[model samples]
Target chain A: MKKNLKWAAIFGSVLLVCLGVIIFGQFSHGTTSAEIYVDGKLYKVIDDLERQKFQSLRVETEHGYNIICYELGKIWVSESDCANQTCKKYGKASLVGETIICAPHKLVIKIVGTDYDKADVTT
Target chain B: MRNNTTVQKIALIGVLTALSLGIYAVEAQIPVSNIGGIKLGLANVVTLCAMMFAGRLAACCVLGIRIVLAAAFYGTFVSFMFSLVGGVLACAVMCLLIGLFDRKQLWVVSVFGAIAHNTGQLIVAAVISGTGSVLSLAPYLAISAILTGILTGLTAQRLWFSPLKRFRITQTRDGK
Candidate 1:
């Protein structure tokens, strides 16, 4: 049973990857509103027009980290002071599938759309 | 050599707890790569080392203490639970695998631990979000886990072999 579970996990993992790729490929483009949050608080809301300009917006939070959003066409963390910077270099968030995260402050900026809203975000 | 006394054990656990907290704080302060929740997971090195040098029970104690203290320091109990569950499960599985193998495959165990850690966290995230779709991130998390695991495991291996080599040799010799 343990052996079976391991194999199942491997196969399930592969299947999930294929599914994610398919879903990502399918919804890769569209004009959508972008939302940003800092420390679980709503910080910025960018519409399709603002998203196109792809300019930089700096969000100063109560926490020590300063979130710099660059490239309006897609939302990406251009700069951040957090230790990992994993969220800062994510480049830009395009499509409904992308997200930028700063784990220390428990902050997450994701592209939420109707499909994602129905599928995941909403409990 | 004699076994560590209670005070020594407590002091060691305290030191590891502090180390893990320091790593966690430092990780939060610097921005390295922005891949959505990807972290260096430096604390795992200490946890893995504790397992090898001290014992599985000792490692568990250190890991548990570290998670609890770190969570309290951060003031996020919910997320702490996620970390604790994920981290403990991963460490236990890795230790078990390593014990079973009886080989110098620290990197393999590290990778397994990391993947397991991510899997545990993903499970919590999915449950919290009330959607199975969050499972979509599993592959990405797995890839990151494998990379970080190797890095952390290598560090642990060096730390274990360098200063503590004599102690390890003695322990194995005495056992036989």
Candidate 2:
């Protein structure tokens, strides 16, 4: 019975993860808008109002790098002068539990909900 | 067989704890993939070693001391609780599961450890935040855990079988 329980727990966890991926994928399907900025100046506006509600703002720096930001969340440099492209691969972060960071570029992308004072995992 | 002296036991635990802290600090300095709290978890190597060498109780003691010391050194007591609960639960699960496998199956143990660690942390986060939304990141964390676990486990397997395997004085029958 104990052995069965362990296997059951493992399978149950895996199943829940699959379900979560599907649900999150759907939640990210709504059209959202984003504003791109370079050096603290407005560069472009990705007006994809028909895209996902959690639209990501992608900024290409003058140094041939990209910074991504979620319209409903925080801003982070997705790519920069680093051999390891860990940040760029992180893609877009929109949920309260999501984050994007470029340590070399000191770029941080975070998600801030309507209630900033709420007890968030980010804190 | 000669048992470890009190001084030797304390020293061993202390050294293991220090090594764990060093791994934590070093990993903190590196800017890895930011999936949010996804870490190399190098300190876990030490925890795994402790479980292999000492008994499960000793492993738990070392983990408890390491978490408390790490929290006091770097973050707050609240953060310490998160690490303590997560590390202890993960290590316990990993040790128990690994008992079923031989040395060749160290990778399996590593994978279990990483998954357990993430699960423990997520549970704590859910409780602290009072919301289940943080549970959304479980998939991402699981994927990362598997990847890192394989790497760390391979390394650990090699370390365990190496000629310099002076850590374990009295190996468990299952360890063979």
**What local distance difference test score does each model get?**
0.66, 0.61
lDDT of 2 by residue, B9-119 (tens): 567777877887888878756755455657878888877776666656666777788787777777555456568777977888886987896676776687788888888
Clashing pairs in model 2, backbone N/Cα/C closer than 3 A? A30-A51, A30-A52, A30-A53, A31-A51, A32-A52, A74-A110, A75-A109
Segments of candidate 1 deviating more than 4 angstroms: A1-73, A76-92, A99-123, B1-11, B167-176
Can you give the TM-score per candidate against the true fold? 0.65, 0.63
Candidate 2, superposed: residue stretches over 4 Å from native: A1-28, A32-123, B1-8, B171-176
Q: Which model scores highest in lDDT?
A: 1
In model 2, the Cα lDDT at residue B130 comes to 40
Q: Give lDDT: candidate 1, residue B155.
A: 93
Q: Name the TM-score of candidate 2.
A: 0.63
Error of 2 at A101 (Å): 14
On the 0 to 100 scale, the lDDT of residue B141 in model 1 is 74
C-alpha lDDT (0 to 100) for residue B60 of candidate 2: 72
